[model samples]
Target: MDLTGYPTDFVADLGFPGAARRFLERRARHWPRLFLNGVPLDDTALGGWQLPEEPDTSESSILGFARDAAMEQHWEDEGYALDDTGEGPFALFYSRYGRPLRAGAITGVAGVPEQVAESVESIGLMLSGFFVVSLLTPDDPATDPFSESVLRDLRESFAE
Candidate 1:
């Protein structure tokens, strides 16, 4: 079960020890469908580093993506569909009140998936349904509701 000749401690190198460990443990449990579109984009080398395709702006953008009308319009500028929800960019992420946001295109999926993934895993339980993360650090008590199993499943499914 060695990966692409990569070292075992690859996730740690990316400053994502927790995420790396999570991915390794869960890769075998989730449906492989999540991996179909997602690439084998792990960066175990260089100290568990996975190169990011976009600049890390999760903190600033997450809210904007969720609440800002102007920004949401821009998200649609690229033809990303906007769900009827009053919310901004994330309205399209789900049909329910709070589902984890899902992006179709890789770039549209995220500007920085690693950062977003960590943010989501570390503190996204408070959100109603499972959701993606992008620098949104909710209160641990409020957000830590998601089960480890759920997060692990997503990481494995989305592991590149």
Candidate 2:
């Protein structure tokens, strides 16, 4: 999938800061690949990916989710985790199949690419993949389009 339009759409939907916006815009050229257990993620594995019962945002809610023993166990069982920095404001979404996905950029951190690398290394399997549309020098590929409902809710949250 051509994610050429994702950064623009994400900014339009979430009004992300300039840094995050720049990251996605700069990285849109790459392709996203979902990985599981250090391998390519597939539909069968995605089948186990689940959306939270209620609306959630990565910055505010997903930390709790990622840290939850039960949720962590579930993601471990599925061989992946949509990791969050517990710092940057990430927008969370579900795939059409209901698999959790995340998009965001981190800025103001010196040596950001290295920073993201360190974060990923620390989390290990807790992070499955990075969005191709990202700030990193070479972002991940296009895995799947984000869920419309999640985008809508994010927009609405901004409105409120």
lDDT of each: 0.29, 0.29
Model 1 segments more than 4 A misplaced: 1-14, 17-25, 36-53, 58-148, 152-160
Q: Which stretches of candidate 2 lie over 4 Å from their true place?
A: 1-9, 12-67, 79-149
- Score residue 28 of candidate 1 by CA lDDT: 21
Positional deviation of 25 in candidate 1, in angstroms? 6.7
TM-score of 2: 0.22
The Cα RMSD of model 2 versus the native structure comes to 18.1
Please write out the lDDT profile of model 1 over residues 1-160, one tens digit for every residue.
1111101111111223344334433432332212211123233332353323333332211111222344334344532223344211221011112233333323222335677755555332332233223321111212333223333343453544
Question: How do the predictions measure up, each by TM-score?
Answer: 0.21, 0.22
* Cα-based lDDT at residue 74, candidate 1: 38
> In model 1, which range of ten residues has the least summed lDDT?
3-12
Give candidate 1's error at residue 111 in angstroms: 29
lDDT of 2 by residue, 1-160 (tens): 2221122133222223233323222222121233322344344634454323433223321211122343344444532223342211122322111233444543333323775766654332322322212211011224423223223333444443
- RMSD (Cα, Å) for all candidates, in order, is 18.7, 18.1
